[model samples]
Target chain A: MSEFLIASLAICGTFAIYHIALWVHRTWNHSLTAPVLVATTLVIVVLITFRIPYETYMVGGKWINELLGPAVVALAYPLYRYKDTLKKVAAPIVAGTLLGGIIGISTGLLLAQWAGFEATIVYSLTPKSVTTPVAMAVTESIGGVMPLAAIFVMIAGIGGVLMHHYVFRLFQVDHYLGRGVGMGSASHAIGTATSMEVNQLEGAVSTISMVMSALVVSIIAPSLVQLMM
Target chain B: MEKVGKMIMHIGLLYIIFQFGNWIQRTLHLFIPGSVIGMIVLFLLLSTKLVRVSWIEEGANYIVANLAFFFIPVTVGIIEYYDLFLGKGSLLILIVLVSTMLVMGGSGFFSQWLMRRKEWKHE
Candidate 1:
């Protein structure tokens, strides 16, 4: 197939899969239908079945990826809108994310190592709490594989999205800020999306937590890894 | 045409903020990413009444709503590392699942505790 045709197929296919996933999520309120997971799986299946290279798929996907920066920047709106709530809970939010980042990285590193995984995989696992972009950078700087970091980040995200509600309920954590910070600190964008589904204030708080966790993890991860070694 | 123009203007403003963030990073040698810096800048702009929410609200909401689409490519890039994951994928998944749960639990409980403490102090 031609590049034009492939690009069209890639874009159209992703759109279709994401819509279906969104429908499923809305209908059943299941986090398992996260659009990113479903769309990624469908896109990969299509690429493999057709023998299209990943690079080729990205020809169309890159357009969507470019928007990620803006989308992240756009988080400021909700953050701004919810600034009063943020101010009220600022102390706990900061403390929660800071400690959460440390706990997440340390626990992931220890487990990966205890499992006897390679150093590279262990390093990749270190930044699993943050979003992909920051996780990838941390992985590379810490001498891990970047792509593996993305995978770990996704796994962490999906895991958080799928389980956070239950985890919060289990602990009787009904506070919006607590729930938001918990999900965002551990799961990043996916968790933020899940929190958004619950409430707007929760979503905004999650965005703040996600950004703060990214900064904290990136700064502390390298030194923590050195200390562990 | 007008909507397109507005969207462009919104994104352009974001780009300008991003540039300011980049400059700050370069000047101070901060480890923070430009987009994050831009987010903070925009937040301050909104807080101080320098920028109205309506100016970028539509574009921002539209972009944030469809944010998942933007990550599909990066997630699919995981195929490039299939071998690394293939052998230990289960273990990695287990670690991710367990640690994520622990992190969520820890954060939730910690924050809840702090909130309760504040409430008690007030009482």
Candidate 2:
């Protein structure tokens, strides 16, 4: 097979699968139907059943990943838009994110360690709360496997989205502010989307918390990994 | 037509910043990723009025809004680790879920407590 032809086919195939996943998410409105989860599964199934090489798929897939860099830079726009809110309630958001991030990282590291996973897996769990690009990057810097980091991030996102309401109710977190910060700091982009689905103020706060938490994790994960080792 | 052109042009600007961030990281040997450094640079630019939000707003929004689409290719890479996770997958899932529950509960209660305390002081 010609490389160029395979690349085009993979790109088109990815878009088709993603759009179908988006439609299913639109109709189902469930965490399980999230576009990322659905589309990734579809693509994986197609590849495995066909016995296609991952290198072949990545010929075109790398093009999409290239956008991730500029996309990360683009995150600054949302952070900029919410400067006022950041200023007004910066104390609570920062403190809450710090507290939860510490607890989350400690729990993840300790649990993964106790489970008898290797050093790499435990290190990968360190930055699992951040968005994918950042989490994967942090994982690499800390000498962990990127795929495992991505999987851990997926679990954090989908699980948080699914379990947030019950957790919030149990914790008696009635206000949108608290809920938003919790979701964004703990689960990153997916949790922000969940907050958006419920309320605008919640979404905005979630957005800020997501960025703030990413910043916090990026600064700390490497040393934390070093300490663990 | 012009609006779309402007958006694409803004993306070009951001791409330049991303490369610049890569250069900075290589020179400084920083642990943070180039993309994140670029994010911080872009944030500082907007806040300091060195770069106007209008220049990047539409392009950035379009990209971030479709963030889930970008995850497709990378997530598919998980196929590479099939055997590595076969038996241990469920255990990893349990660890992540429990950690997430702890984070949500801890963060939610902490923020609400602080918020209530601030409100009480105001009253």
Candidate 3:
């Protein structure tokens, strides 16, 4: 097959599966039906079953990835909408996120080191808490493997969404802002989407936290790595 | 026709802002991602009334709402590293899950604590 034909099929197949997963999520209201997770699983299954090369599937996948850059840029809309609320609580949000970013990177690095993982694995784990693009960039700057960093980031995002409700209930955290900030700082985009399901306001706050977490981590991660070394 | 026109215009504006951001990042050698700089540019444009929020609100909301869909392809690309993950996948999963919970708990607790303290001071 021509690359054009294969790429088109890959894109169409991904969109079709993703919309189906969205429909399933709406009908069943199940968290596991998160469109990204479902689409990823289905795509992997098809590729493996058909013995298609990952590179072939990526012919179209890269196009979709390109769109992600703009989608992330779109996040500024919510940040703009919620500017008033964010200003009101700006001090606490900044302080909390700064603390969260520091604690997250340190613990991951320390744990990986104590566990005796290789340096590359430890480097990859350093940026696992932020969104994939920023995380991958920070990983590279800090001498980590890019793909491993991406996988670690995806795992963090998915795990944060899955554990958020239980964590909140256990901690008796009833504050919406707190919930949104906590999830966003820890899980990034997926957690923000999950927050949106419960409340628009929570989702808006999450966008801020996610963006702020990325900014802060990118600024400080290199310095922290130097400090560690 | 009007809504469609507005949507196209808004998306075009966003792309321009993103391009500008990329330019800035490259010139300054900033470590931050270009899209994030684009976000700040959009925020500033809207806040300063240089661009009306309503102009882009519909398109931006549509994109943000479907944000996960945009990430699907890049995520599926993870399959390219299937071999690298096989040996250490379980360990990675454990570490990710544990650290995620810790970050969530730490941030949530801190924010909640500060909010309560502020409320107490006011009352």
Candidate 4:
């Protein structure tokens, strides 16, 4: 088959699979069946079984991936929707996210170094707390493996979303401010989505926290790596 | 026709801002990502009332709603490292998972404490 045909197939096939996965998520309504998790796994399984290479899949996949940047830019909209609360309660939000972003980076850096992974892997782990698109760009700027950074962000986001309830309960995080910052800083987009599902205030605040974490990490991750290295 | 036009205009404007951000980052040799800068620029525009929410709300909502879908193409590359991951991947995953929990607890506790402190002050 021609590359164009193959690429078109890959693109169309992905959209179909992702929609089906989204259906499964709606039906099951569980974190384990989350759309990103299920769709990614399903696609990987199909590719491995079909003997299609990752590069070929990406011929068209890159077009979809390129939208990630604009999607990130779109985050500003939701954040802006909560501008009043942001101005009214900016102190806790900023403080909480600053601590979370720095602490998350520090602990991940130390853990990765202690694990004795390569330097590239360590760098990738530095920006893993932010959303994938922002994390990917930060990974490149900091001389890390970009893909690995994305994987780390996904893992952190999913894991944080899954564990957030227990974490909040145990920490006595009864307020929306606490819940929002926690999920947003640690989990990024996925966690923010989950928070939004549960509470509108939490969701709105999570959006701010997520954006702030991205901005904070992009600025400090490189320096933190340098200091620790 | 108007809705379609507004949607197209929204995307085009966003892309231009994103590119403009990239240009600034490139010329000034800044480390921050252009997309992030664009996001801030948009937020500032909205806050300043230079851009109305009605104008760009739809496209922004669609993109943010399905943010995960956009990254699947690149993230699927994790499969290529199947061998390496299969070897000791579980351990790496565990470390990140645990740290994620720690982050949640730490941030939640800190923010909650601050909020409570503020409440106490008011009382």
Q: List ranges where model 1 is wrong by over 4 Å.
A: A1-5, A49-51, B1-5, B19-29, B120-123
Tens digit of per-residue lDDT, candidate 4, span B1-123: 987787888877778778877888789876567777788888998989998888789888766666667656755777876664566777788779878888888887898788889889999
Question: Which of 1 and 3 is the better model by lDDT?
Answer: 1
Each model's lDDT comes to 0.82, 0.81, 0.81, 0.81
The lDDT leader among the candidates is 1
TM-score, chain B, model 3, is 0.87
In model 3 chain B, the worst 10-residue window by lDDT is B81-90
| Residue range B40-113, candidate 1, lDDT tens digits | 98999998989988788877776667667767787788788777556657788889889999888898778878
Pitting candidate 1 against candidate 3, the one with the higher TM-score is 3
> Per-prediction count of colliding residue pairs?
0, 0, 0, 0
lDDT tens per residue, model 2, B1-123: 999899999999889889888888999987556876898899899989999988898898777766667667766876776665568877888898899888888987898799889989999
> What is the i-RMS of every prediction?
2.0, 2.7, 1.8, 2.6
Tens-digit lDDT track of model 3 for B17-63: 88888899999988677887888888888889998988788888777
Complex DockQ per candidate: 0.63, 0.60, 0.66, 0.58
Give candidate 2 misplaced runs (Cα > 4 Å). Answer: A116-124, A131-151, A157-176, A189-204, A214-229, B119-123
lDDT of 1 by residue, A154-217 (tens): 8888778778768888878888878988989999987876676566688888888899899899
Ranked candidates, highest lDDT first: 1, 2, 3, 4
- For all predictions, the C-alpha RMSD in Å is 2.6, 3.4, 2.4, 3.3
List pairs with backbone clashes in candidate 4.
none
lDDT of 2: 0.81
How well is each residue in A34-112 modelled by candidate 3, as lDDT tens digits?
Answer: 6667767888899999999888888998988776666667878777787887788877777777877987888888778
DockQ of 2: 0.60
Q: Spell out the clash pairs found in candidate 1.
A: none
